[model samples]
Target: MSAESDYVTLISSDGYSFVVQRSSACISAAIRRMLDPSLGFAESKTNTCRFENINGLVLEKVCEYFYYNEKHKNSKDVPDMDVPAELCLELLMAADYLNV
Candidate 1:
């Protein structure tokens, strides 16, 4: 696969498209299964997963956490990820949806 194929685009409910690394996205079990070819979903064929219930902002945060998790996955020290106060509840809901 070429460098561009190493990533996938996740489209949020509001039509925001986020291109994230496939390896990074696998950090979330839900996403992994959805994107897995064995499952035979449209996402696996197109490398594009759509979340109609997840808004763009929540999806963006989840993607950010995925990358952050990867950066600290093998490290002893993990930096803090600060979520804005107002977004805490929404972030939690998104986390639940992502099974992260």
Candidate 2:
């Protein structure tokens, strides 16, 4: 692995993994702290976080929202981002886990 720590692998309970840019993933304060080098936490060293309680499907949507938020971070009139009705509860739970 490179020493740059430019990306992070988010591992879901079912072993699904999503690799995303560190910058974009840092949109969540919880994730930001996990990746913060100064914190010297295990996650910061490995650039990965495992959510044994989260399933892949919900995690996927949360990761999408992270990128969406990043793209609209500075926009004044950002368009509404939609989530599937069936995923509302799981999405909310995942958001809480990610502090999104």
Candidate 3:
């Protein structure tokens, strides 16, 4: 498995949680590191990410992508064209938000 801090948490709309690589999370061009200079007790324990815009179903699919990438960690495989229409849109939105 990858190093721990190398990953971050992603919470789905229904409050489901998934772990994603910090590098992958950086895919979101708009995301900025937390601006706070000091570490507050709350921030340390709740590193889990909160994504308010995406619903549960979409998030499930995004998690699938993350897992898929993990499997292809060494290969430059092209994105499979078999994604469902709804999922495609959701993934796009999620990717856009994460700036992947």
Candidate 4:
């Protein structure tokens, strides 16, 4: 795992597991702080990332985006891919989660 912490378990609405590293999970600032705070970081009761408004396919797209970003954090030479509408929604959700 490329993350700096333990593996995180993101659970989907229909009972799906999205295992991700702390670094990859940090892609969403919301979950980052909530799950692993800089100070007073504690274990959360949640074992999942509970996307109440997002569907499976869209969440999958968001996970794909996270993977891509994590895989190419140092490479600025990559070209942009055509983003789907659902992905836009997922990004919005991420922004909302991060409260940015």
Best by TM-score: 1
Candidate 2, 1-100: lDDT as tens digits: 4435778999999999999988899988888988787887788878888988889998898889889988998999999888899989988888887889
lDDT of model 1 at position 37: 83
Q: What is the lDDT of residue 22 in candidate 3?
A: 60
Error of 3 at 64 (Å): 1.5
lDDT of candidates 1 onward, in order: 0.86, 0.87, 0.61, 0.63
Report the lDDT tens digits of candidate 4 across residue range 21-97: 76677777767666754443443434345666656665566667677878878997976745777468666775576
The order by descending TM-score is: 1, 2, 4, 3
- Which regions of candidate 4 fall more than 4 Å away from where they truly are? 1-5, 37-47, 98-100
Summing lDDT over every window of 10 consecutive residues in candidate 1, give the lowest-scoring window: 1-10
Best by lDDT: 2
- Candidate 4: residue 17 Cα off by (Å): 2.4
Local accuracy of candidate 1 as per-residue lDDT tens digits, 1-100: 2222689999999999999999999888888888888888778878888999888988988889989998998999777987888888988887888889
